[model samples]
Target: MKQSKVKWTKSVGWLLFLMAIGFFCLQIGYLIIQPRYQVEYIDNRIFYVINMLSIICLYMALLFLLTWKKIWTVVVTTMVTLFIIVNVVLLVERNKEVKNISSISPNLQQIFAIKQDTETGEAMYYRSYYGILSRPKDRLEPEIAGDYKIEWLANDIAAFTYEAEDQTIQQFIGTYGDRQEDSMSYYYVASQIRGKWGADNAQVERQNNGIAITVDDQTELFGWDNVEQFGTLAIVLKKNNEAVWAISLDENFVANSEEIEPTVGNISLYKATMEENDPIVLAYQGGAF
Candidate 1:
């Protein structure tokens, strides 16, 4: 029975020693690959704790195998303590250098995050498709600077505007859905009208999913499915199977006009129910137009 007990102790000690060696090799591999790639941990603190525990296990295994050797215990304990302290300092410094700003889409189907390096003032944008578990984030804007202003052009389209380091305004679009899927047959018409148009207090924005009309603090949305185009001359917006608004383009405006910019055009807005009312002329402000 004494021999069997000794054999069991040897087996357990060897097993733990193998595990500790495996963990140590993994740490070395991580260090080698870390500079070449960006490594993400779901929980950083837990990862550090696990590594520290593995080092402790190695110390315990060495003590068991060598029958409580004093030198092995002291050296391994000191190494383990130093490992913990170094990892803790690295984690704290990393947290201080990086800042994450995130926002959820209006439909709650997607999430966008910006990982900004505070020291260098460099920012990278990422997006994730939300599901039971969100997939790995896909990198969007690789490098940008300054504060970001996000606007949802549609449920799946985000427009990010920011002032560059050179003090010029720049915009980046994060489109999660296919443009063809939403516009379909009226793709050209949709493309032409997709922008912000204004006339005094009234504003019209043709988005990926819908047309947003705002007047004197009141806004109404007409889904793309409810919008009808009559060539490039005009478009009618419908709500509940009834025409609510009509937009008529300039008579001289040609779909293929080389003289005119895509974003520059004149348009008139009239209440479909009351055509007698004076139409509003809206000038193109921004977007695809």
Candidate 2:
């Protein structure tokens, strides 16, 4: 008589093994896409707990298989299932990187809060805006140079970061269709720095991904939409100069119509600065007509 041993089917065991292989394969791929933590410090603690749990699950599955336990299939299946879930989570989101850099005063006179750059590992950062940095060759065409200009001015904030050279600038008195290359700094400058003086009831026009608004009788500006609200003009003003100006121009080079001075200073994209009868320093942060 042939005794029948526990006529156990290896099918369940094979299925679990295959599932485990798939889960681990995906897990390996996920690790590649995940960001490596350079510092041991972690932002979230729950994630660490999840990592430990996964290892335990994997271990229990192998033990069940070796013992020929009836629940081995379920245990292994759970392991693969957990792996699939964890792998998905790992690919979904990564941590943001942080870094530090030196803080130079606005006038470029002195340095503060020195730190290393995350990307290059170099020690460099920005503080104050002196006169806009320009290469000698970056000057505009002679004819176009008559309208816009970049130069230094005095400051009110008295902080190192607020000591940027005031850019006293002007633009072509019309909407822009084509971008001017040589005078791009004027355009960038006009859009970035802001003027505070303007009638609240102003004409704000927006077109072609550009913005234009009138601050008052004296100032207006054309700008790139994305950077306007980024705290550039306000930050610069608060840091360097005591006198402040701003313009709330529209996205399409349109004007605003309010009773108040829509502009922050003398103009919008076109900014003029004064320091106790000093020469007017105009800077343009965006495009011109």
Candidate 3:
């Protein structure tokens, strides 16, 4: 019975020692990687607290596994306790120096935050790809200050407007996905056609949810629910499940041509049923593709 009890204590001590070692390695790995790539912690204070607890576990394991002199054990425990307290105070003071303002993308796939130093009023922005574990944070350039306003231009594009120290309004664009490539699957045509287009006396605006067609002084909305793409060249808008308008890309316009801007393309719109009306040629003015 005595031997079994001793063995059990040793096993528990080893388990605690292994856990403490694992925590130590994790902290070391983070320190090494942090300079090259900043990592976003879910809770910065909790991380330090966890490391402090791991140290306590290591101390307990040492007491359980070995018979140490009373004076030596007291010295080690005091040193460990002081180290933890100093670290906690430092972390708290450091955290108090910065104010964070964060915004998440519409798709919830990305996060952007501005960390402003309270003492110096200096600021920097960071972007992180949202995930379960700690995510890599990219620090962006153009140091800014003052309050900020965030607008989602699209699902993946964010526009940040703020005032500089010079009292001028500055704008920063944060884009998440690939702008040059069509990475999305379903909205290939819609994504390409999104933006402002102009014909004779009419204007057309294609957006994420729908398209707005303006003729003379009147405007009509064609919801995405009623729009269908036929092949890669054309899209038809329907009302009451009946095709009303057809928009087709200009035959001269080449799709996926590196030389041409994705947002700069020509298209034609006309009645789907009647060929009597001459097709209106529209040129892309500006917008996301």
Candidate 4:
């Protein structure tokens, strides 16, 4: 009877230990999954979960070892073996996916898939006349008293300057004077404006009745004039001299990315327009694909 009681106590203790390990692994999983901006963290979390599960199985086997219980030993051994096999398979797949995403036609897929593909009947982005998402918002030095002020913009009738939160914004194509009931009409005007800018930048674009299609501009975007274009600089759609929608290249427009916390190049942090319907966030994990 005493020996039986000891065995029972051992079972309970092992159960608790296994439970604790599982819980710890879950916490680690949360840390990895919640931070959507990290690619590696997501991958790491997956591996750790498998590892924890394996440990639990091994621990159960050890408990059976103590009691010389054949059934328990078999169960634990089977669990461990299964988990190890699973982890190996997943690790192989994970590595393959990472390599392709980092190397292949990353830019083309991001832009076309997230926004440009009209066949999907999805529209998270709109074109812009003035390059609102073009350059990083000019900001004051860390020690300086000045803050991020949207100071100046190139003078053009197509695009005008406005103010919001001390940020002087270059209003692209939309209804500056009056709002239009038809959203398509507004987009048309903005497209024309974008076409004009494309020319100034020495790039060519196609303007349809209400749709403006932007082609590739010959100029180098990043590292031009010793400036790096982090995310993307795409066209903005305007109507009645107001911006209706602003289209981003690979990802959404990011505001002052150079100054934002947890900074990455062209991560599509936020929209500069402050519109209610800003472009959606695809994945914060990688910037501009």
Candidate 5:
């Protein structure tokens, strides 16, 4: 009976030790891949839940290793229960706060929000525009007093700048004026058309001056300015040997091809536009191809 009791104690200790290691690995992995955007709200929720569970597991493992007894087990169980309840309450409050903020600040478009700890008042603030997902709001040091205030300013800057860029692209594309609702990039739009029509002989070429389209024995050229003539850009698609839709950059406009993030270049292609005739229209507003 004495030997059996010793063996049981060793087995319990080893099991708790292994569980602690497993929990630690889980916590490390979560930290690595936690979502940073409000667009990934589901992922954010899962990360938080897993984090809380890992903490509980680690704490239980410690308790078990320190005192292998029924009382320690009871203590750990009670702590886990309390921790779960508290976390759930916090989650509910956070969801409510997010909803309220969204309704009140319709323009803010909360991509992600960082809540302050009720006890410790610390958080990492974040906001995002259409730029690369991981880019910071800004690099300049702010004159703001608090972290939250500084973050608010950063978000405002990013949003305003991105909004201006968006307006510029739209104006260049002439989406509000002569251009039809259905428009897309020349490359994608042409490929889609060719695929749909089963025209294996169709070809598209991007030249220094503009784009050239050839089908069978016929050829047509749509003129655009070279890189030196910044902002003189246009996208054209032809179907049945005729131009379907075309948009060009305004002559007065200047191209801003500066990179937003490390690898992502400036905005060039407008999003895929669909027309009544099922044509995909894309506009080359500005920047490199």
Candidate 6:
């Protein structure tokens, strides 16, 4: 009877050892596939806690095999229970975040797919606006050479006009397309837009001298039926700023509506624009744009 009990305990320990190894493998595989998902907004406290729990599980699994004592067995069992409880809590929170993201329409979801340059880690994300594929440049670090101001026309929409040293007036307007709850830092979004539609392929329109990346109509493309509501991010840049203004309009307003402004978020954006007195200070603002 004693020999049988010892054999059974050893088998259980080996099974736990295999589980520990599997857990580590799974974590590594996930990291390899999805590096962006690791970025945490609530600080990294939760990440550290998870790492600590994983370490404890590994230690307990080792002790279970090294020592058959009842005290060690109890400790291993307790640690496993704790690990399971913590993981369940985290999984629930992750599900909630997923639900929030799912609220976005499928057509819009496809527009946000980000591709990163392996060497530079720079990302390129773009969306089709009307028939044009609009994207931002890598110059996320906005240069405040002279007097310039970014005014928020709405909670998720903003506009700015500036004149470069070469007497060229630059105008840029953008909308926060992602849901407010899941919107990433401005820097992340800018990085994602930097290179998807390169400037080379884009042709400047004769009317506004603003560049547009055009594409043929596709059934799979979002906004094929109703192109207005599916608009994600739109920017109209004018060459030499010749009476140029790009306004994003949804179902609420007609295209080229002089009164309409760029819109974002499900909630109606407030019609308020806050002017930043000192534009150079934006360099220190750090990616919150």
RMSD of each candidate?
Answer: 14.9, 18.1, 14.2, 19.7, 16.1, 17.5
Candidate 4 or 2, higher TM-score: 4
Q: Rank the candidates by lDDT, best first.
A: 3, 1, 6, 5, 4, 2
lDDT, model 5, position 168: 22
Q: CA shift at 207, candidate 3, in angstroms?
A: 8.2
lDDT (Cα) of model 2: 0.32
- lDDT by residue (tens digit), candidate 6, 1-289: 9989888877877776776676676556545644543322122123434555566666666765685578867877787778777776775665443211101122432222222233443333333232212332223112223344454434344445444344444444445553323333322222122212212222112112222232232111111121112124333423322213333322222122111333222111111122333211100111211
> After TM-score superposition, what is the CA distance of residue 161 in candidate 6 from its true location, in Å?
44
State the C-alpha lDDT per candidate: 0.60, 0.32, 0.64, 0.33, 0.35, 0.36
Better of 2 and 6 by lDDT: 6
Q: What TM-score goes with each of the models?
A: 0.38, 0.21, 0.43, 0.26, 0.30, 0.25
lDDT of 4: 0.33
Ten-residue segment with the worst summed lDDT in candidate 6? 279-288
The global Cα lDDT (0 to 1) of model 5 is 0.35
Model 3: CA > 4 A from native? 38-47, 100-114, 122-289
What candidate 1 gets wrong by more than 4 Å, as runs, is 1-8, 35-53, 70-72, 99-114, 121-289
Model 2 stretches astray by more than 4 angstroms: 1-19, 27-54, 66-209, 212-289
lDDT winner, 2 or 3: 3
Model 2 / residue 227 / CA error / Å: 5.4
Candidate 5, run of 10 with poorest lDDT: 156-165
Native-to-model Cα distance after best TM-score fit, residue 175 in candidate 2, in Å = 28
Which ranges of candidate 6 are over 4 A from the true structure? 1-5, 36-78, 100-289
Model 3, C-alpha of 79: deviation from truth (Å):
1.5
Candidate 2 per-residue lDDT, tens place, 1-289, comes to 1222222323444555566565555445445543552211112222433454455545544553466566866866686668757755653433212232223334555332222223443322223222211111111111111122222221211111112223422111111122222343223323322332223444333334444444454433343532223111221221122223333222223222321323322333223332322222222232222
Candidate 4 C-alpha lDDT tens digits along 1-289: 9999888877876776677577666557655654552222212324545565647655664665366578867876787778767777776655444311111122222111011112322212222222211111222111111121121111111111233233333332111121122342322222212222232222322233333223244322211122112122434443433333333332222233222333222211122353332232222232211
Candidate 4 vs candidate 5: the lDDT winner is: 5
